[model samples]
Target: MIIDEQWIYCPVCSNKTRIKVRYNAELKNFPLFCPKCKQENLIDAKGFQIIVIKEPDAKTQSR
Candidate 1:
């Protein structure tokens, strides 16, 4: 499905973004990136919810 916008932002960036959805051949996963912070995000096409709030990853949580 084609979308009007094509990028998205990290949760810390107010979740305001419009990222492109693409397949990663290495991980076999669909990944999105934050335009503002340039952070990479993983969003499952089949199960991910729109306007979803992302939790900090293990690395970020440790900080």
Candidate 2:
């Protein structure tokens, strides 16, 4: 199997993150957590860009 990887940066702190993609997987908007800033970021794998989804609220996080 061929695996593809993409490097993503954290918008809040500019932390580098690596994500692996499978050949058959669909590339779409996904949520990622930044370890340094502790924030959820939206990523667009198809466009190779980071998109702003929404800030997670305390209530949603608790669940």
Best candidate per TM-score, number? 2
RMSD, candidate 1, Å: 6.7
Candidate 1 Cα outliers beyond 4 Å, as residue runs: 1-9, 19-28, 45-63
Per-residue lDDT of model 1, residues 1-63, tens digit only: 744333334555767667543332122244666766877766544212334435566876753
Q: Give the lDDT of residue 51 in candidate 2.
A: 61
Candidate 2, residues 1-63, lDDT tens digits: the string is 533545667777888755554434454568877877887777655545456666577887974
* Local distance difference test, candidate 2: 0.64
Instruction: Give the runs in model 2 whose Cα sits over 4 Å from its true position.
Output: 1-4, 18-26, 54-63
State how far residue 57 of model 1 sits from its true place (Å).
10
